[model samples]
Target: MIMKYAILSQTKDLMPTLGLGTWQAPPDVIENVVYNALELGYRHIDTAFNYNNEQAIGNAIKKWLNDGKGTRKDIFITTKLPHVGNRASDVKKFLELQLKMLQLDYVDLYLIHVSFGFHCDPEKFTPLVKPTGEYELDMETDHIATWKKMEECQKEGLIHNLGLSNFNEIQIAKIIKEATIKPQVLQVELHAYFQQLKLRKFCEENDIIVTAYAPLGSPGAKDHFVNKYNYSPDTFPDLLGHPEVKAIADHHGKTTAQILLHFLVKQKITVIPKSTSENRLKENMDIYDFELTPEEMNSMKKLDKGEKGRIFNFLFWKGVENHPEYPFKLSDDKD
Candidate 1:
């Protein structure tokens, strides 16, 4: 029973305007969170292989289905392919791994985690840091070839919908021109501080759906995933508490999370915010019945500072250069 979902593209259906991000939550808590989210009417869950918790989500889904609370078809599950797992044979192989871990045959959507392929094999899988870093060692399987395999997976029914994450406009343009199946969804680092208006508009013009992360901006938590590498929010007014956002939150008597979420929902973009706390889980799922007014939405839009954009700084990942999806200020792009 999907209580709420944002129809991103013309095809994909009923993805809750708000879902949970599974970046660094503990596996044990993630299990409980999944069950709690379902109980609280959250019909969507977003996890990735890189998050190292897909199996936990999968197990929880299995239990929910086995207990008759909901069937496997009831939940909207989305995961992604790791850069190291982009080779054709490796993709098929990793897809099997994800399937077995989730205890499900197919996912609602499958995303390519990064727009580039690894520079080496699994045994020698390495990450690149800077210009001096290594590029693809396996020259045969670049990003396009990997995407071709992903397209094959879609055809074989391993994945129902396809998306790309951490990709910039140029990278997406290349894929859009070459791809037989255009991306139905695009996940990017978006927040009140960095609204990515142009990127969002480009995606919308191309009929692609946008998914945002860090709506309230990074909370300055130091973990392996969202480390302290982000530009501090301390200098900037907290988006969740800004007078504008507060006024909007007070308008409907909802929390800042709900307001932040509704802002994106109004734009018809999907959001997946992660929380292990049961109360927060319930609070996050209660946004289906309300809508943000045009005035309020426009007010929030003014909060866009457009400085220090992008939170997913995969400077540690290898083979990120010259492939065209490197998500930084290009020479020609406005700096």
Candidate 2:
């Protein structure tokens, strides 16, 4: 029953490598999902302001604590600053609001949700869009100033660790140059298909622990994007159904997901795969009992699809690729 964890370089805090990802989780169902996860021995919960389910998650954690299941100190909660709150002036305001929503005095980690910013009416909490259906860009969004504010929040004990999501190497380097405290984590899209080898190497050199989102290649994302944004790529990689992965899973007598998760955790990379089923939740955390052989690990490594393997390009934001701080180059634009 040994659980894996990564120690934050700055705070020496232990973050459970396997966390429950709450993105796209329905509000009504999330409370029960989170509570069940805690009962099943999950100690890390990954959420975000834009996810709009923090209150539900908070209620679950509150119930778990009230029932004497666990103390607040036993769980690590990670939330993020939304794109609308990407500037220095808005960091404290949003963090306080998030704290209020989560009913917590402090968060274990707070990440800047993305590198780019968007103009939005604060009351609505949705990005302001132009007549062309594109989000109104906040071109002057300043990463260094925002990082300064995050550092200040860390000093005030509001956030134990500060990190970034959806930020590229160049954007991260800019922050590191001006940071009094460097980022402790970098969460991004990662799976066998899109391993992010270069970025992981860079973060490794900088002592930033990498967390893999969509660790199963996010099988449901294509439909989600199509239904919501009327967009879908010509092709999407299916890691779960891959023949190589299945063969390995069959040999190991484990589920495809367990194999996928173990592959990342074996490399010391963190993974947060989203699922609402009680059985799947329990199944996800069961990877600790087994280990992947080096040959099996390398077999999965060959599945890397590089840039084209990426599913979350943020193109649904409609002209985001044109933004100065857009972290990814379009697949067509790549050499």
Expressed as tens digits, the lDDT of each residue in 142-214 for candidate 2 is: 9999999999999999999999999999999999998999999999999998899999999999999999999
Question: What's the distance in Å from true for residue 296, model 1?
Answer: 2.1
Give per-model TM-scores.
0.85, 0.97
Candidate 1 lDDT tens digits, 1-335: 22355665645566666777877777887987888788777778888877778888888888888889987677888898877675666778777788888889898888888766654445543333346545553345455666788889889988878888888788888888888878888988887767888888899899887888776564523244334334444444466667778888998999987888777766777788778888878777677778777788788888776645454556534445555455666333321
lDDT of 1: 0.74
The C-alpha stretches of model 2 lying farther than 4 A from their native spots are 1-3, 332-335
Model number with the top lDDT: 2
- Scored against the true structure, residue 235 in model 2 reaches a CA lDDT of 73
- Count of backbone clashes, every candidate in sequence: 5, 0
lDDT values for all models: 0.74, 0.92
